[model samples]
Target chain A: MDVRRRNNVVVTGPEDGPVLVLAHGFGCDQNMWRLVLPALARRHRVVLFDYVGSGRSEPTAWSEERYSSLAGYAQDVVDVCEELDLRDVAFVGHSVSAMVGVLAAQAAPERFGALVMVAPSPCYIDSDGYRGGFSAEDIDELLASLESNYLGWSAAMAPVIMGNPDRPELGEELTGSFCATDPEMARIFARTTFLSDSRGDLDGVSVPTLVLECAHDAIAPREVGAYVHDRIPGSVLVTLEATGHCPQLSAPQATAAAILRFLEHPR
Target chain B: MCRTEEDPEPREPDGAKDGDRTTDAAFSALLEDSVEELYESAPCGYLSTLMDGTIAKINSTLLEWLGTDRETVVARKRFADLLTVGGRLYHETHFAPLLRMQGRITGVALEMRTGDGGRLPVLVSSVVKHSGDGEPLLIRTTVFDASARRSYEQELLRRQREAEEARRQAEEARRQAEADRARLTEALAALQRSLLPAELPVVPGLETAVHYHTASPDRLGGDFYDLFPLDGKRWAFFLGDVSGKGPRAAAVTSLTRYTLRTAALHDADPAGALGTLNTVLHERYTGDDPRYCTAIFGVLEPDRDTGEVTVRLASGGHPPALVTRADGTAHFLPTPGGLLVGVLPDPHFVTATTVLAPGDTLLLYTDGLTEARTGPDRTDLYGDEALHAFATRLAGPPPGGLVQALTALLDSLGDGVDDDTALLALGVPARPGAM
Candidate 1:
């Protein structure tokens, strides 16, 4: 299989620069990195891709059994790395992808050098003494929300959203197709993302890691960010002055600066 | 109403008439109902929010529908705050992003929480209002009640699910029926084998071959054949077709085969064996659905000195047997004026005798072969004359070769041979050293 076409891998930067693979989280595709790409690509080689069943990636490659767990997504990361034959690469992950990076680093430890987790949460549901910011019922509510929006994301509503005349700044190619995914595939992804518990895997991170969290995120609260930082030994935690679960879109400069600073000086 | 005649005197150039006064009063009344009244009591709900989705202003119609006052909602709640948890997630993930990119979105379905804790289904349309320099300033939205429409859509979805389930059940039933038919065909094949000989017995100095063809797998054929030794120097054989098809005819065929074998062991004469079978069948099936069969029973005796076989056969309304000569000639060994077996109290059985010389074959068959339809229209019967001609064409072949040729002929007839057929051949080898 051509893994590049299957994952929609896009590589952009100086030819001889150090490699930085940017992975997007749930609910969106690699286009989530649009705001931070310009700054990060200046001196570092940046790689971007949509996981199977998301964005422009081929939908035919998606299977419910493979993608129902975080391990399958990590395999996608390992596949892209092996396909390009890259070594000592920096892996940047957002939301649920941050945990996916943790898994990929463990599976192929020699391929990845450093890890950058933005708005990362190892678990989303609260249990024991840990506050993951959501109850089990909230995840079920989120799945229900995904089903309700299925009609809106169906083919019937796609044309109206694609033919926007007012905001030409939002390019024609990226407007309607930005976050539109197959509804059934999105349901499986939502269940996988919101129901996962990767807290135990955080302790095994052997490489230099940067944990970037937003100031006020309802999805991944500050305590969940602290839990991730405390679990991984010698990891640096920086709280960006942004709201919501997506700091890259809400505060791109701070997000990129923190990542670049960690690459220059790992302490 | 008569003012025109009453005021017949010369009027002033500038004058106020009664019609003009009434029109002025009506216009003043229309102007009194102001824009604020129209906005507050419109048919649909309306609201305006800031660029960040904070509710800035809302009309009375929407406030009443939400069952809240301006003081509690005007600046305190954002548009996302008014929605249910599921709807809020949808707004953040798909709706808000599309609205930000598209500048305007219409007829998006969502559910809102009412003041009484019930859910209100609504359709919303939002447009981003832009400033003179084209920077987005605020958002204007309209909401329409969609309870009836949502209920209708739910009904459609329910029916669609039901139809899919019904179709799935139908497919499962069809698959089950096909499996049952296949198992029945296998059982019928096994039963049919039980009525015939597993393999024909070898008679010293005589070559024998046989073939049976069935037209349908679902229906068991009424044809049977068997060959067995009667004594030290004699072998007896029989080939027959019962009157009908399937289990009823199959039962009669089974009875006839066993009776012929038992009777041949008791009395070695060809006529005596068939006479016993007719008596047993007539006594066993004496009702309205009387069963009968056409059969040729025969005994073979090989002459040690001449290396030839003498065949004595008795026919009960069966087709005459054919003998193909070594010198490329063929003729039927006739057993004339015989009646069908088990049809009368005492059926007359005619006996015929023929000898197979070196390199000559004697063939016995049921009438299914001669009764087979042929020609372009398939209305013509392949009669005794045609069989004689066909046998004459291949007169010099051995018993196995002759039976093989006839099997191929039956196969070529295909669907035209609608009945079951059975053929048996006996021949003597021309060269004693070759045998």
Candidate 2:
């Protein structure tokens, strides 16, 4: 059967090796992993894809029924891995994808060997005694914010995650991240992220997992990371000294080192 | 007449000098009497209180306002006692301590108790008189009769409250308008949702998912999407954003949605389908308040045996589609330079074609995605490159899973996307032994 590659540059490594699929977070694609992925690809088969409604994914291929929940996305990982006949999967999901892996693993636990959730959040809004740290009102305000001004909120929030980019700020820096997903997709994604009760998904993440909590992450604070660690029993929790939501981007060397060590030792 | 220095000093006659001296003394006495009388007989009253709030002295003006006897009040009863029931309690609870600490309390309005038990409202200004050594002495107070002033203030307050009530009514009216708009938006959303399949109708050899989020109900966003039957062999679908937002925006969206269907029914030309919708909007809103849209209309014809979808798209000011392959590679299938719908009497839309091979997913969306905000350092909008990376991850998911992930991705954006957005994805299951 003849299959076509959909993107610009395709990297081919070993035919039969452990699969390391890299999933990006909000406002970024697989390219973000370019700095570290080359190292991982040397030993393992690397697979990467853009999320639907973003990157190179076909817009017509996106459906509310299919893309309404992140679990659907998790299934996509399994589908991609199955397509490659890959096993003992090491899926590294950043930010949102970090939790997406959990939901996917719950759907097909037999397929996944381990997960490295980088700067993850199962639930952003805190509950009573729960350290999501954000109040229900906070989430409501967030939703209100998105509803009122999609571009404006994006301009404000995207920086918090992509703070201190590798380079200097251009005048248009504030408006940059928002240009990725269509504003409409953003509304759907915002409602899903802020409104989702993913704590339930946390309990189901049973694989040997490493939850890397960023030190100064404004979005996923220390407390929520602790909660994620506590819920996934036997899951080792490590607070990465690196500060910011995208430690892999802000502090790549440290992030890569941590992931390499964790992958080798089953932390 | 010049008088030399030696001239006799000016002198008045005895009768004149006597009269001038008597006149000056009488004028000074008169001025003093009137000035003293003004303070004594002013409209308000003045008094002094001991540090303990014992009334030390009182003037006739105070007595008149209170309708009380100075003999019975001053040096006998405490100042707090001179207040009516509520005023006395208030004095003890709120006023007394504030005056003691601050050394002054002014403009405190209270009703004084008359001997007949009537209450007369008065504005009181009090100061804690201190000695040379800074030791607190008597409290000197001035009282102004505020009956007329209070009535005037009350009338003004009443008018203000009435105006506030009117303002609230206006707000309620505006809120109702918003609610009505929301209801209309809800109805439109419901109809729009129904127009698309609850699940993308499964054509053999294809896994499909689509997501559509209207920006808000405050204004009916001009975004609309649909997935329907073109024929037994193919499916018809389109997602679009009307140029404006509101009823007019929704109108154009509905027209686009319906016309695309009708055009596809007539003949499955994605370009012709969009062209018809464009024509309709052009004709309807050709007036000064012009409306336009950007749309991506496509037909998914699957080769069941090979498991491939030959996708043909017609774009009207829409972003290009993204194609992510089974092997984790992705790029945008550029469909650029399409004129906006209703941009001209006869606008020309563009068409692009791609084949969705097995183990691949295709993403279609309005510009809302790329225009999404990414803050901080990458302070530009979410661009095509980032999305390409996103699609490369999900190149292998089923439709349901794809929508879920896309929905989550959208959710992560929060307010980054301030526009209504729509997403459509199609990917094929892995054939055994492909890896």
Candidate 3:
């Protein structure tokens, strides 16, 4: 399998520079990193990729059995790393992909060095005095949300949105196309991301990790970030002065600066 | 009201100026009242949220629909707060991202939670308001009540689901019907095999072969043939077709086959065995649906000193037996005026005797062969003359080879031969020294 084509792997920046693999989470694809790509690429060889079922990745490569769990997504990460034959690389993952990075680093420890988690929650459902910021019913509600928005993500509307007649160049842009994935694949990814519990896996982290969270995020609260920080042996936590789950798009400079600072000085 | 003066160009039109001033005053009052009323009481709801989705301004119509006061909604609740949990998730995941990327999104369906805890389905369109320097400022959104349209869409979806389920059930039923037909055909074929001999017994100094062809698998064939030993020296062989097809005729054929074998073992005379069969069938079936059949029962007696088999066969309403000579000539031995068995109280069967000399073969068959249609129009019958000619051309081979060639001829007839056919051949081998 050509992992590069299967995952839609995009490589930018200097060849000899340190590698930073950026993985997007459940909703959008690698295009989510567009706002922060320039600043990080100046000093690092940044690698961006869409998971098998999302973005511009090959749709034929997606299978419900493989992508219904985070391990299947971790295989995609491991495949990209092995395809490029990179070593001691920094992996930056957003939202649900942060736990995916955990699984990949454990599966192939030699390929990954440091971990960067952006606004991630190991478990979205709150349980056993642990506040993951949602209930089991809420996750089901999110699935229902995906069902209600079926028309929004339909393939019929994709061409109309991508082919904006007033600005023909925008038709070629990847902005509107990033979030238009196959709805069935998106539903599986949603169920997998919201139902996953990776807090126990954090204790096995042997690499330097950065936990980046939004100061006022509705998805991942501050307590979840502190809990992740406390679980890892020597992990560092930084709160970006941003809102929402995506700090890369909401506050790109702070997100990029904090990442660059962590890359230059790990300790 | 102003009226035109009859005296043209004389009056200063004082009355007209006074009337115009009064009308202008009333129109100004009406415009002032409509400006705010249109914004507050429009048919659709409208709102404008700040960049982070804080409701900065809302019209009175939207507030009324949400069942909330201006103080509670304006600058207090975000746009997502008014929507149901599912709708909020849709807003954050798909609607917001698309709106941020494209600057505008339209006709998105969502459900808002009213103050009374009821749901109001609505379609929303939003556009971002940009500053002069192209910096992001706030969002302007319009909401329209879509209760009627939502119910109609629900109906369409329900109908679509019903259609899919019906199609799936139809496919399942068709598969079940096919499986039932296959099982029935298999059972019928098994039953049909039970009526025929598993294998022909090997007779001393005699080479024998037989073939049975069935027109349809769904219906059991009425044709049957068997060859078995009668005593230490002589052997009995019979080939016949019942009066009709299917299980009823098959029952009669089964009776006919067993009665002849039993009667032959009792009395080895060819005419005597057929007489017993005719009596048994006539006694068993004597009603409105009287069962009858056409048959040929023969006994083969071989001479140990010379390669000669003496054949004595009796035909009852059956075609005449064919004898292919060693001299490459074939002729039918006529058994004239043989009455159909089980038709009369004492149906007389005609007996024919022939000597199977070296390199000579005797063939017995049912009428399916002679009655088969031939020619381009399929209106002509392949009569006894045609079979005689065909048998003459295929005279050199032994009984097995002759049966094989005749089976191929039957296959070439294809759909022209619609009835089931049975063929049995008995031949004596030529002496090795003789030409």
Candidate 4:
């Protein structure tokens, strides 16, 4: 009851290096950032924390509006920056978190130095000019599938999102991870994430952006990565050799190397 | 026609019968076969035509129906000759060409000459049989007694008219229902209007735009948003959706709205105000039909000098706000951990504070935008990511553009939007140089 909700963040890396905040996206929390943490933390002041809804983060705080979009998650970046008084913080977000960072940086421009968006999708529905990869029918079918069997869908959706549905363990682990979390919250979150449209804000990001495109990411396809790259002005796009959505989980070295490379050279 | 007489068994005929017994058997067989014979008494017309419309045969059925003899219809006349003058003309124009192209025409009604000099109705169907060499051959024709079929058709027509009348009535009823639904929606929209601020007060330093899109107009929706003065220098706004529908959910929403405003009035504390609303909802709708809502309650303090407005937001079940800059960039203000308004006693609400600089706009809306049903390829659930992306494009426009775009969006949804939506936007106007 006395939880002030302030001290939950964990920071590592060089004591006086530039602040670099790494945000994990929709399903998993800060733990998902483990792979790239050591590599980034060694050179910069690495900031990591669970979003109020996932990982070790508090679950009771999630709301329909607050967590309805990645923007809230993006604000977490700015909030963390302000709380820690981060200056020129380099933000590296994975999946949706990357998108969240892009918006957050746009909101509080001074707080952000550069953004690295890995395997990001701005919109899931195709418009006249853009192919959002799914049709209205496809999304409805997906929603129906999720509605019918949430747990099964979560397990099934994770690997698909990660672009590694073939691995049985991937499904098992995702289901296990998603199931251990609050199903109701997870359900709403799932609906919110998949139904989001962030294509509008891609151009608004003024800071230098590096969009990391995963070659075989199921959720954020290469085309989507390119889309993000196109909307962002002077945004550098890097295609990773790795496959899968959570490259940090599946292929950390490649993911880390990509982030490091982007940080070293800013557009 | 003459009937063949049958011989009764002769008393001696039985004993004197020939070994074949042919006498009685032949007479009886002949008499019995005559009974089974269909005497095609010319009740209605029957006739046949040659390949060139020449009358080849005619039956008593037609002759009696027409009150005429076979002499008038046989080779002495072509089949068309039996038709009335008007019918013969029709036979040459529309009917003949259709039959030629189709190779068969059936059930054609034509008038025939009666011996009494009266006309009778008849229906004819014809089939043309050709030789193997593709030479035009004879046309076999069948005539039907069409008086009953004509009556039956009339009866069908009458029934169809009645059915059509009934359908029109049903359609009228449906139209009435739609009108009622529209009225209810209009009333509901009116009621919903009373929940939010009619128009946002012009924040001196900001370019503010708010847009709301509810998926449908027929049903009362759950989304609500408002921006009002909290104190002299500060403003409070919150966008949220209440759970459930009807009066119960409306009550929850009303309570949440009032609580946020009053709580903010008391403390102007973003987190504290939302927490107050959450506690009130939990206590009031505590049992049975538990109610909860997601709200993003914000406290915007405009800084006159830098033309920056710092937005302190505490979310309890609401979507994040999109901040659009004058440079035409849009992004969501992150407010991560916020409980749905009514569930927990001490539900967690995450507050992430950020400043929207001059020429930057912040947009807050309910989940209805993201959850809108549209898309050519997918269920167009315009979720958070898409909204942010949408706002991202509106970055360079004035705040009013956001409202305009959203209004248009909500309008497009028509009846698909089952939920009510609320939108509130705050923007720091672009400096003259920036624009």
TM-score of each: 0.80, 0.37, 0.80, 0.35
lDDT of 3 by residue, B1-435 (tens): 111122212223334455587766665565564445666776778788887788998889899998999999888888988988767766766677666666667778888999999989888877777776666688888888988977876676578669999999999999999999999889887878778988888887888899888775566788888898877788888888888888888889889888988999999887788889889999999988899888888888888887788999898888899888877888998999998888888878899999898888888888778888887655798898889888888755678888999889888888778888989988887668654
lDDT of 1 at A38: 91
Predicted structure 2, TM vs. truth: 0.37
DockQ score for candidate 2? 0.01
For all candidates, state DockQ relative to the true structure: 0.34, 0.01, 0.33, 0.00
Identify the leading candidate in terms of lDDT: 1
* Residue-pair clashes, model 4: 60
Model 2 over residues B200-245: C-alpha lDDT tens digits?
6666777777777767665455677777777788888788788867
Cα lDDT tens digits, model 3, A103-213, are 999999999999999987888889998999888887787786575556444543465476543323345766456567887899999999989999888888889999999
The per-model lDDT (C-alpha) reads: 0.84, 0.69, 0.83, 0.67
List the candidates ranked by lDDT, beginning with the highest.
1, 3, 2, 4
- Candidate 2: residue B24 Cα off by (Å): 42
Q: How many clashing residue pairs appear in each of the predictions shown?
A: 0, 96, 0, 60
The structural similarity of chain B in model 2 to the true chain B, as TM-score, is 0.56
Candidate 2 lDDT score at position B427: 71
Q: iRMS of candidate 1, one decimal? A: 2.8
